[model samples]
Target: MAKPLKCDVCSEPATVHLTQIINNQIHKIDLCESCAEQKGITDPSGYSLADLLVKPESQSAPEVAALSCPECGCTQREFKKTGRLGCGACYETFASVVNPALLNMHKGDSHKGKVPQRALERATFIDRLGTLEDGLKEAISSERYEDAARMRDEIIELKKAMEAAALED
Candidate 1:
């Protein structure tokens, strides 16, 4: 028998799929892919890093606030104040400073968005579009008509799925 179904959006095990969030003491309801896209929302949340880009003269460290690496002679104050590291070792040596700054700017270490799916079909279709389009580009570059035909079919299938997802909105 096939494995039990799971909510494709959130990677949770469930026969039924759902997408929701709690904001302002109220829960945002589940929306299919098209619905969510039409609303420009995602299941996962995201934050802007505009604040991280701030450079106030007052917040700047003192003249002797430099942190020099013993081995590479890199300074911690330079990295923190300017938000630029000279070498890859800076990531390991000064993680404390780098991590919090990133968290403050991005709200998380990674910036990947957790988009909610108000409609699942639309998400699937958009995914398919990427694969099909890439495959078609590759086949055309290699002058392969047969491969192009296969990509065309995949695109058609994706478009159909996208249409179905849109109807859910």
Candidate 2:
């Protein structure tokens, strides 16, 4: 005898299956036809999956045409329409426009990606110290003395913390 696939929402025989990958995690959902219809998943004229994935800034494509990546010659309008960047330089070129959208999509602007348990603390401290150092250098180069001083102090503190952590380990 074959076992029936049940809907996650209502326990009715599942007629549709959906898979979504979010933040490197796979999420699966099963739904009966009726439940799927109620959720508008079955609507032929409704929003497509790509439409759902589009960022809010991408909704107004025409407005973005004026801003284009110098390196790849990729217009913001093209990025909005395709939801993909043309080159690595696109990130730097479009940073101002993309940062807010990225912040809305993720927890923060900085990448706090997964690290192995064995080296987590050291890796984290090193990453933070590196970022602070970079900021310090940029501030100094830009002649922002107050901001440079603050970044320098932060970097020094991070280095001290890293040393303490290493001693404890």
Candidate 3:
């Protein structure tokens, strides 16, 4: 067979898959037959490829105009495109749209606060682990194997704490 078309969003080969891409990011839109089967999503009425590709008229969709602030009704496409907001309230106003877009653009690394406070604590632990890892690298470069080993232990302990806290969260 000829080369398959790559997914426009992920730039990966689009093998029995379908999704929505906006601004060079992908969102799970509709599952193809194969993907739905893989995901164990069986609709009683059954869904066709057309059902996935064609949005129904009854769905109240947001306006796709990039010129206006999706949250605050601010008309500034240039700032939005560049990923900078004009005001503090922009975060609150556009949070719904902004968070997901930011998460997708940043590869699921954006702060989504639905998580518990313990997750924040876990994150701090991860940060501390990172510092320890960095220190270990520096110590090793400076011929301080002893300090490096100490930092390695600290990092291991910190990582275990982070994992435990994450499970609790």
Local distance difference test, each candidate: 0.53, 0.69, 0.55
Q: Give the per-residue Cα lDDT of candidate 3 at 78.
A: 38
What C-alpha RMSD separates each model from the true structure?
Answer: 18.0, 13.1, 16.5
Prediction 2 global C-alpha lDDT = 0.69
Estimate candidate 3's alpha-carbon lDDT, on a 0 to 1 scale. Answer: 0.55
Q: Per-candidate TM vs. native?
A: 0.32, 0.36, 0.33
Could you give candidate 2's per-residue lDDT for residues 48-148 as a string of tens digits?
32232333453455555467788889976577666567998887777766665455345666676886774987788888888888888898899999999
Question: Which tens-of-lDDT digit does each residue in 15-98 have in candidate 1?
Answer: 323332324332113334553343334435631121122223355454324456655767754554544567767665656556
Query: Model 2, residue 61: displacement in angstroms?
Result: 9.9
| Residue 142 CA displacement from its true place in model 3, Å | 0.5
Clashes of 3: 0
Runs of candidate 2 exceeding 4 Å displacement: 1-63, 119-169
Number of the candidate with higher lDDT, 2 or 3: 2
For all candidates, the clash counts are 13, 0, 0
Write the residue-wise lDDT of candidate 3 on 30-137 in tens digits.
Answer: 334454554344657544332332223243144433335545566334343343566666666555455544453355634555876775676788788788988999
